[model samples]
Target: MAMTAGVLALVLCVLCFAGFWLGRQEAVRIRSGGVQPHSLPSYYGSYVALVCGIPASLALLIWISAADSLVRQFVIAGLPDHLSALPEGDLALLLTDVRNMAYGRVPLNTARPEIVGAVEHYLRLGEISRWLMWLVVLALAIGGLLLGRRMVSAEFRARNAVEQILNILLIASSTVAVLTTIAIVLSLIFEALRFFAKVPVTEFLFGLTWSPQTALRAEQVGASGAFGAVPLITGTMLISVIAMLVAVPTGLMAAVYMSEFMPGRLRAVVKPVLEILAGIPTVVYGFFAALTVAPLVRDAGMAIGLNVASQSALAAGVVMGIMIIPFVSSLSDDVLNAVPNSLREGSYGLGATQAETIKLVLLPAALPGIVASVILAFSRALGETMIVVMAAGLAANITINPLDAVTTVTVHIAALLVGDQEFDSAKTLSAFALGLLLFVVTLTLNVIAQRVVKKYREQYE
Candidate 1:
């Protein structure tokens, strides 16, 4: 189906271009006959292209989205009554097996006769669905082309029509983005609520212990699991604070030097090289933290008579700060550079030195943006998982000390959802609760940052 959709997209592109050429030539031919074209030749071409592509693309999208559920329904309907009447979980697994067999993921020879028959039926339905989709889509495209050609008279307002369609498309794209965000929030809320139903909200929020293990059988030992989130919250804050301590001064100073002191030619060369840190994958940073920084931190701690765990929050936080340096420096650089030169001139004209002007004038003016960049970097640190997982062990220790092994909310979120398990269980549902907590914390941070930015902005402006 994906291949067919790709081919159909290529075909539509060719057809739309053909429609464009035909419409443009028609408009030109009409103008040559002394009837002035309604809009530009390009507008006429665009009108034809939009007409040829939009309807067919919408149809193809609808068909592809609905195909899977329709296939499953048909396959299930063809199954024997006993097989079809299984519980929802069993039925879902049966359908998965049917799909696996149809796709050759499972060997058919070892399967039951009914399963084999269902696989055959699944293939047949899928083939029919694909062929029908192709036919309907192409027919709509060709029909739209003919209609668009007929409508391309001198009186037709091609530009207005085209612009209206484009406006609608833009609105639709925005709506999709907004809806996706809402959907994510709603899903997290619903699942978190389920987790809360099983584990008391107060206990999960304030309890000091962080175990999430639940026994499989009634007779199993250590069945009751503690779901206190304070430890995870503390670990997250500890690492993030350490990261900010490293990132803020370093990144802000780099920004200050580059934007103010460095020559323009040197700035141009250095800024991109500095921002390249942002492009390096987080896993590589994780590796550096685990193999290089962790050991160095341990040795340095030992050298000073401090007992540092091999996998400690200090290593993760430091590497995470390094990773976030570009986010801070690049934004801060732009913000500092954006401060009007008039302010600097005024400060200098008043007998202030360069350093004094930077301290009293430039930094004050760019405080809002600088704050924003630091907040962005802090958010990046809070959400960092790989470096924490590799450099800081998953102990969920409720400690403020950077030398201790700890885990953040994101690391545990990854841990909780790693293996195949029952989604309804408290162990799995706890991930959603953690996600909700993280979301609230981030949203709170943004709100605080906004208020700070607004207050400073008002005073400065």
Candidate 2:
């Protein structure tokens, strides 16, 4: 069916192209006879092509989406009475096995006769559906092409029609984007509400213990869960603070140098090389943190007569900071460069030194963007999981000290959902609660950043 659909799409594309060519040629032939077209030849072509393709494409999509369900119904209706009378859940499972066997994903040798007959019926119905889909879609395409060609006169207003269609398409795309975001937020809210029902909001928000192990059976030992989330929140802040401390100053200085002082040739070379850090995979950074930075941090702490865990927040934070440097530097560099040279000249006109002018004038002017970049970097730090998982152990310790093993909300969220488990269980549903918390925190940060930016922007502008 997939192959048939692909072929149908290719055929529709070729027909649309033919419509475009014929429409364009007709407009040119009219112009050769000295009649001015209502729009450009290209507009005429686009109108015909869109008319030819749109109906066919929509029909094809609807057909393919409905085919499987229609085929399933037909096959089930033809099933023997005993099989058809099974409970909905059991019937669904039986259909799944039938599909697997039909697709050769499972052995058919042990299959019962009714199951074999159902599989054959399913395949036959699917094949008929594919043929009907092709005929209906192609007929629509041909009809649309003829109708469009007949409408393409010198007064057809093809450009206005094309632009109207494009506007509708753009609005639809934007609507889909907005709808998708709403759907995601709604899903998170619903699932998190389920979790909150199982665990109280106050305990989740303020509880210090972080263990989420629930007993599978009544006799299991030490499986009573603690859903307190304070420790996870504390660990997240510890790592993110450390990361920002490392990233902000280093990245800001690099941005300042690149935008203001560095030679153009050297800046060109250094910028791409620095940005390359952002391209390296996070898992690779995790491996580097575990094998290289963690041991180094442990050794350094020991040499200073201090205790540090083998997997500590400090190692993860520092590595995460290094990873986000490019994000900060790239944005800050663009912002700094956007600061008008006239501002620099005005400061220099008053005999301000280069360092002093940058400190007072350029920095103030670019403050909003700089703040935005730092906030972005902080968000990046907060969301980091692999580095934390590999270098910072999932201990969920509520210590301010970076040398302690810790875990972020993201790490715990991932840990909670890693293996097979009951979806209704608090252990699994807790991941959604953590996700909601993270979303709220991120949204709050964005609001704060916007307020700060708005204040500074009004002053600068």
Candidate 3:
């Protein structure tokens, strides 16, 4: 079908070009006869090309989209009522078998007449559909070509028609993007609601314990479990805060020096070296944290008479921050560099030193972009999992102490869905609840960032 479609597309392209040539020559001959056209000869040719291609492509898309489901229904009609009434999973497997047989991917048993007949019908219908598409599409392309040529005249508004079609295409693309976002949010909401139904929303939101184990029977020991999300939330915030503390000032100051003070050659060398941090795999960062940094942190803590777990939040967070530095520095450096040199020059004209000028002028001008970059870096730190899993042990401890082992929302979610899980289980469903909570937090941060950006933008621009 794909090959056939490609062939049809090639044929249509050739015919559209033919129509363009004919229409263009016609317009030229008319213009030579002293009749002025509303548009150029090329515009008339383009209009004919659009006529030949657009409607034909649209019909092809519509037919391909509907063909599979319609053909499946036709095949299912010939199957036994027992097969039709089978459980969804069983019916799905049967459908797969039938499709495999139809495609000669499976050896069909001569003993089953109904299955054989259904496979034959499915293949036959597919063939008929392909032929039907080829005939109808080619016919439409020829008809559209003639109509476009007949409509071509001195007064035709070919450009206007093309523009309207372009506007519709733009609107359709935007609608799809918005619809996709809505679909994601709706799915999360539905699943989270299912989770909340089984576990009380209040308990899940405010409970301090983080166990999610449920036993198979009431006679089992430790059958019931706690689902408090406070520890996960607190641990996420703790690691993210530590990461920001490491990333923000360092990344920002690096950006400032590179964009403002460094020589061009040094700046070129250092910037790439720093960005190399971002390119190194997170798993590498994880292993580094686990084997190298975690031990170092433990030794440093003991030497200073402070107790620190080998897999502590500090170890994970410091490594995670190092991973995120490039995100901040690259974006901030670009933002600061993008600030018009005119602004800096104006400050110098007022007898401002380079340092003072940057503090009072360039920073303010680039504030919006800096804030956006920091927010992006913060989001990355919040979502980081591998380093946390490797360096910070999966203990949901609600402590702010960086020396303590802790787990984050992402780690918790990953833990909950680690193996084959029943979707209806509160244990599995809790992942959705945690996801919803994380999403809301992220959404809130985005809102705050947008407000900050808007306020500073009005002042700067």
Candidate 4:
């Protein structure tokens, strides 16, 4: 795949350069004759480049999509009768092993005589297919370049042609986004429906326990699949609340201090250092939460005569909050700065103190954006997985106590889909249902944020 892509890119670049030079030469000669072309020479050149690049790109995309499957089918058809007579699943695995051997993923020489011969055949077919793809794509690019070069004339509307192609590219980009969103929603809904077929919706929504372990075999022990999700929902909300509790006050205060009181030199240095927290990986936070914070919390609880779980949600939530502090602080600071200096000056002109001016004028003006930052931080809290996994153990207890170990929806989804399993099984399908729920929750938060922004934002002239 990588080799084919590089070759196709080189071909497209060469053809684009050829078409650009040809059209530019034609435009220059006409301009030298004291006749203005319909558009700039550069626009004509761009038009030619687009003509050469677009068709070749589309052909290359089509070839890459189809060639692998076509090659696989051909190889499968020519397999030995005994291998082909294997069950469908086994046969599929056999073919994959043969291909792996051909690609050096497996030892090539240890295979049976039949498998050895088949590996050679698969390699030969792959080589032929790649060569064929390169030929067809390059031919299309050269053909487009020649056609575009012949069509460039003094009266040609190169600008209009370029604009039309630009519009097409924009429409294609928009269509891909729309189609991708629709596909994801449809896929989730489809799998959730499959899950609902085996497990009652009421059970999943209202049941207190969430045990999604179904035995693949009837003879297996301890396979009672309880698909309750309320505990997971409760844990998610608890963690989010803890995170927001920690982030909102501290982040907003930091933003207020930076915007209203701190010196410019100190603010500049502190701001980036604070934002460095956001760039650190969640896995790193997970480690800090588990190795450092969890122990601290446990020790603190013991010192204060309180019981704390080994893996407490408080530890996860606090670290997660610290991780998302920049999200709130940075946005709130920008919004605070966005409040017109005129408002502050007017307040000061009325003999108000600086603190009063901030409290009375700036805070209200920046409230909408501050609210958005908090909501965003909450959403980030709810979506966190690694921190929860490492610090808040996967014990789905429906409790609001921060010191208790609890698991969130994302952790459960990851657990359900960690290893190979049948997609049609209710246990696996539950992940899609959990995903749909998470999507709705995030969507609701965004909608509420938008409504608040629209209604309450302070408009400035």
**Using alpha carbons, what is the TM-score of model 3?**
0.77
Name the candidate that leads on lDDT.
1
lDDT per residue (tens digit) for residues 235-292 in model 2: 9999999989889999999999999999999999999999999999999999999999
Query: lDDT value for candidate 2?
Result: 0.91
Can you write out model 4's per-residue Cα lDDT over 76-175, one digit (the tens) per residue?
7888888778887778888889889988999987889999888988899989988888888888888888888877888899999999999999999999
Checking candidate 2 for backbone clashes, the offending pairs are none
Per-residue CA lDDT of model 3 for 29-142, tens digit only, reads 889999998888988888888888789888888888888778888888878897788876667778788889987789988528878888888889889989999998889899
Clashes of 2: 0
In the range 302-379, model 1's lDDT, one tens digit per residue, is: 999999999999999999999999999999999998888889999999999999999999998999989988998888
Could you tell me the TM-score of candidate 2? Answer: 0.88
- Per candidate, the number of residue pairs that clash is 0, 0, 0, 0
Which pairs, if any, clash in model 4?
none
Q: Rate the local accuracy (lDDT) of all candidates.
A: 0.91, 0.91, 0.88, 0.90
**Model 1 steric clash pairs:** none
- Model 1, global lDDT: 0.91
- Better structure of 1 and 4 per TM-score: 1
lDDT of 1 at 406: 93
Question: Order of candidates by lDDT, top first?
Answer: 1, 2, 4, 3
